[model samples]
Target: MKKEMYAFVVPCSARPLVFDESRCVGCNRCAEVCQVDILIPNPEKGRPPVVLYPGECYYCGSCVMACRQEGAIRLQHPLMNQAKFVPVRHAADAGEEKPLPAEKRRG
Candidate 1:
């Protein structure tokens, strides 16, 4: 049986964002949108961008949205590989359709 409705049903207690250094095209698009209140500029040099407030991330998918490369930005949620995503049953579970929290749903 599935566990109780977790305000944070996510598996990992704390997960960090992982980047593909090679895939990053240095478009700086992710950095642009994140300037307001999303992320901090990563000084590292690579395809995958970096951030400051990783834990504070709202998972808005903006960085990924601005990504022009194939595999530039990737979200590596905590206990992701170990976690299994069960489809949302009721109307409450379904929030947005376009980006259905791929990391959370990846079983």
Candidate 2:
């Protein structure tokens, strides 16, 4: 049977966490501590964990705390502020969406 599909873009209440691939050691500790289950181990060992559900991220920093590699994973609020309006790519749209300022973040 032929099938059709549609896609939608979602804006988040708060910024999602960020990962530094260069600093990540693929230990999976961050995935272990994520309360929302957004992170999962990479299929190949010795690779950084993947964001299984970006929308489910709470920016709780549990993953950051669990990381043995300093500066590997961190909250996006501080980084966003310092970066001065970084734009994130959305699959559904050609234009990038700007991240909300830290003061505007709900959670």
Q: How many residue pairs clash in each candidate?
A: 2, 0
Top-lDDT candidate index: 2
lDDT tens readout by residue for model 2, 69-92? 998876766444555556764533
In order, the Cα lDDT scores of the candidates are: 0.60, 0.72
- Could you tell me the C-alpha RMSD of candidate 2 in Å? 16.2
Kindly give the stretch of ten consecutive residues in candidate 1 with the minimal lDDT sum. 5-14
lDDT of 2: 0.72
RMSD after CA superposition, every candidate:
17.6, 16.2
Q: Once superposed on the true structure, which residue ranges of model 2 sit more than 4 Å away at CA?
A: 1-15, 78-107
Residue 14 in model 2: lDDT: 55
> Which regions of candidate 1 fall more than 4 Å away from where they truly are?
1-13, 35-38, 42-48, 80-107
